[model samples]
Target: MTLASLDRISPRKGRLSHTTVFWMVFAVIMALLVIAPFVLPVFWLKFLTEILIWGLLAMSSDLLLGYTGLISFGHSVFFGLGMYGAAGALLHSHPANLWLAILCGLAGAGGAALFVAYFSTRLRDVYFAITTLIFAQIFYVIIFTWTSVTGGENGLIFSRPHFAIPFLVDFKFDRYTMHWFVLALVAGSYVLLRRITRSPFGMVLQSIRENEARTRAIGYPVDRYKIVAVMLSGLFAGLAGVLYAVQNEFAAPDFVFFITSGDTIIFNVMGGIGTLVGPIVGAGFFQLLRELLSRLFGDQFPYLIPVGMVFIVMIIFLPQGLMGWARRWLNQ
Candidate 1:
């Protein structure tokens, strides 16, 4: 083969090698996670479950920010809605059916996503973000003041529903079972999002991200795409919230605030935006860092000061994020 031909082939080989290594790492990590609930202490198991929930939320944010180049500061709205929807179902229903609660959560989140997308998707850049933020605040106020239904600031607590399938599997959820269930759902979501990002629809979203004008000029319905993207992202975020509500046995207004959305953005920035796994890793890292700092400094010391410092450093030095750095290393 000609030297030029060999040079062209070498890059392909490198890409193949990188892909292989990525999947191998993914499989190993998943295996460890599967075993974690059984081996880890109860406290750590609960912590890990929280990380997975937050990671799922981060991944949902990534679907818009990383893939579609849409910055949504109101994902917490969808999340909170999901939590409340589940809480409402479980609290009001006689049997407290797990399926009913999950369906309610999904419906509430999906409906909210559609409503938000219809209006917010028309705006571009910072306007879109502000619109989302406003929507979130509006929901927050309603939930906080509506004491008759939502429990106001106290939120709503309910019993953990039994995990059941029709004439198939039925059981109560202890910490271990809950952890495994959350892990399964999160992992499934990761896989589904990964597939979506590689599909033709994902390509169009990326094109829109790169140049909205060009994508629109190419005959694609840019507004429609953006709207769909927002809805999809919101649905996933809502799912994360539902899982969190289930695990914690409560739903609170604090989670619906814009601050949660901001933290999700931070997770995307810390993890590497475009990569599916990055946000999850970012969530885990962020949580672990906060835990460590809080332990060292105590609650009164304001651990966020140190956490913010580290985030600033990462932004300055590792702007592409942890996954981006890891990719570069693997390519080398």
Candidate 2:
């Protein structure tokens, strides 16, 4: 089939999947999440909160890797910067500025993304990935060595904020409240992203991912689109970082380390790239698996073997990951 014929066959001008039931399922899930903290044990509540944060990180990375055809191995830089941004605001600058801290984290990460994308957009494939990785490493080094504000090896610790939102409900970031807060953030982020992905801009991004040269030839500014997408991804990662810092009540250099980036990749790929909800599910499953494995073998290293096995199995049987596989199955 010719390219034009294929294009005609696949129309990109519609709302995402006219399946009301699919959306309703998500609504139900959100309702469950609302009540989850009440029933879940303390450990599970904390674990799931971590999953939500990681899920946001995975979703952000997938926005570039899956939708924009950008492979960035150092996406965790934004997440780490976000942690520091919030920590710096709460600890060093303004103790009671909750919104300001969150904004600072988001702005810092978004600004960093623009800087990285400016140079990284010129490259493609492995070069793009490596460049991002190098930049991330540089940020990690800076954070690790900046002992004055960051506390270097010791990491920075701070109390959770008790911000009072005007007109809206005011709450403290205790374990229970924080769990619900993260849940709301994750759900809202997912909904916002889903809307974006179904909009015209998102369609253009998919086109760029499918054929960048063709998209550029068709009068689209591919580079500019990529930068915007990366910025959005970074902002989302930063938001996740804010939540991460709040949950742990600490900010560590390890949040920006290369391994953290690698974990997001694993979460995205294992959950099914391109499907936003997949990353959340994948993160939850990964965390649960790690918990189970650690309990079974009495160490975290044994979890590696199972993770490797899962990766190999997915590659051999379901290359597209869990969500992708589920999609294919449902369609069939």
Candidate 3:
């Protein structure tokens, strides 16, 4: 073969190898996680489950910040609404139907997303971020002050719903079962989001991220796209919240606070924005760091100081994030 043809074929082969390696590694990690519940102690199992839930939340934020170029500080609103919606259904319903509770959570999150997107999408840059922050604070205040409805800072606890598939399968979620359930949901979400980020619609989102004016001039409805993206992001965030409420057996107002949204953004940044899997990795890493630090230092030590130092170092040395660095190394 000619040198030119050989060179082209070599690059293609290299790309294929990289892709294959990635999938192989991914499969192995998933297999390990599947078996983890059986081997790990109860405390570690619960901790890992918490990480997966938070990872899902981080992935939701990545949809907006990484894909849509929208910095949202009101994701906590959707999450909080979802939690409350599930809580209300479980507490008030006669049977505490699981599917119905999930639907309620989705409805609450979807509605809030539409409401926030209507006004927030019109603004750009930091103004949009500020608007979302304000909206989150507003919702937090409402949830906290509405004594009779929201439990007035005390939050509401509910019994766990049974996992059922009509007449086919029905069971309560023990620690192991709960971990498996959460893992399944999270894996499904990652697959869906990965598909989304690789689709034609995802291309347009990246274009919008790069240059909104050009995308609009090319005949795309930028505003409509942004609103849809926000809603999609919210849907997943709400799902994460529902899972969290189910795991914890309670819904609290603290989660609705803007700080929660900020932490999600940090996860995106730390993991490498625009990569769907990055945020999940970031969540796992951050949580592990916190757990380790807390154990070593005890309650008296301000762990955030060390965590902040590590974060600063990461920003300075690995600005593209952990996943980004891995990608670069693989390519090299």
lDDT of each: 0.89, 0.83, 0.88
Model 2: ten consecutive residues of lowest lDDT = 1-10
lDDT of 2 by residue, 71-116 (tens): 8876789998899898888886544577877988898898889888
lDDT by residue (tens digit), candidate 3, 190-285: 989977876788778878988999999999999999899889999999998899999999999999999889989888888987777889889988
Considering every candidate listed, which one attains the maximal lDDT?
A: 1
**Candidate 1 lDDT tens digits, 177-256:** 99999999999999999888878898899888889999999999999999999988888998998999999999999999
Give lDDT: candidate 2, residue 73.
72
TM-score (all chains, Cα) for each model: 0.94, 0.93, 0.94
* Candidate 1 CA-lDDT value: 0.89
Residue 85 in candidate 1 has what lDDT?
A: 89
- Segments of candidate 3 deviating more than 4 angstroms: 1-19
Off by over 4 Å in 1: 1-20
